[model samples]
Target: MKADRIVSVIFILIALVFWSQTFGLQYNCSIFPHLILIFLILSSAIMFAQTFFAKDIKREHLSGKDLKYIIISIAIVFVWIYMLDFLGFIVSSVICLSILTLILDQKRPMPVRTLSSVAIYTLMVLVFWFIFHKFLLVPLPTGYLI
Candidate 1:
């Protein structure tokens, strides 16, 4: 079995499991998990299709720096998820976005980086505030400061 095929199979299996679990959960309760399930399934389908249908299967070697970036990205996301509730979405997200942008855009101008981080964080906060507070009527997370 080729590496790409193996990864594709694993993704398909995981997607199936997530899809099943989504159905097993109580209906009309939490929509977030369901949306995540759909995303997983869709992504898996794309991966599987790409692996099977694409003619080229030549594996490209990941440079050390590329691997480091990938690992850091995953770590940042994990930390963001863990800190979201405790730190509140705004603070946790701002930190995550700032750090990620800095890591990914090291060569960019300082002003550009700062403005981009502030804009991204502000947009995320506004979106979450609008969706949770206004649309869904769910209470926004109030951190220790609040």
Candidate 2:
């Protein structure tokens, strides 16, 4: 049981759990989730299968700094989700995406670069907002900011 196999197996189990829960959803509501879950299961299954045939399996150990980064990123994601209802999708997404970009970025944070990064994230969020809220007629979580 290599790392890839273990991760794929875990994803498959998680997908199975979500798949079961989708049964209670309305047909229309469940369709997207089902499609995504099916994709997850298929990809994980393929990865699991590939793990066996993969040669020269090099297991890289996570350093303390990398582990810290992972923990921080996960915490940021949780905070972003929690903020969505209060700050709305656009505000929360832009803020969180900016933070994530700053954290993951290794380059020196110049003023123009940081601003551009934020602008890019804002544009991306707005595009998604328009697609889901306007184009698809799907109501997104709205708050004071949006």
Candidate 3:
């Protein structure tokens, strides 16, 4: 089994675990998390099967630049998760999205990136505030913002 196949299989198994936890425990499926988990499980299984049965397993190579990007992305995600508790959804999300957009945009102008980041973050804030807060009745972390 190639590394790719092994990883895909592992992810598929993990997704199954998540699905079981979501449904078996009777958690809130009103948010569609379980549906997303099912999709992940099915997609991972399909990918695993494809990789396992491929005649010519193209060796997936990770270059130094690719590794750097992966590391940075992971670091950003870590900071985003940690900051969410301290800074709440709005502030932390805006900073995270802005940094992510700046990092991901290769040739886009700074003004465009800035505008895009702000727009995305604003939409996220509205969605969280309206849908999650008002409709779903999910309590957001209050980090001195409100």
TM-score of each: 0.65, 0.75, 0.68
User: What's model 3's lDDT at 55?
Assistant: 81
Cα lDDT tens digits, model 3, 1-146, are 46667787788788777766665554554248777777887887787788757786456789998888779988998998888788887778778878877886677657876897689788887787778878989987657564
Alpha carbon deviation, residue 121, candidate 3 (Å):
2.4
Top model by lDDT, which number?
Answer: 2
Model 3 segments more than 4 A misplaced:
1-41, 52-60
Q: Highest TM-score: give the candidate number.
A: 2
Alpha carbon deviation, residue 110, candidate 1 (Å):
2.5
Q: What lDDT is reached at residue 102 by model 1?
A: 83
- In candidate 2, position 59 carries an lDDT of 70
* Candidate 2 lDDT for residue 84: 90
Ranking of candidates on TM-score, top first: 2, 3, 1
* RMSD of each candidate relative to the true structure: 3.7, 3.0, 3.7
Candidate 1 residue lDDT tens string, 56-138: 75677999999999999999999988887788877787788888888887586598668877797878877988898789899
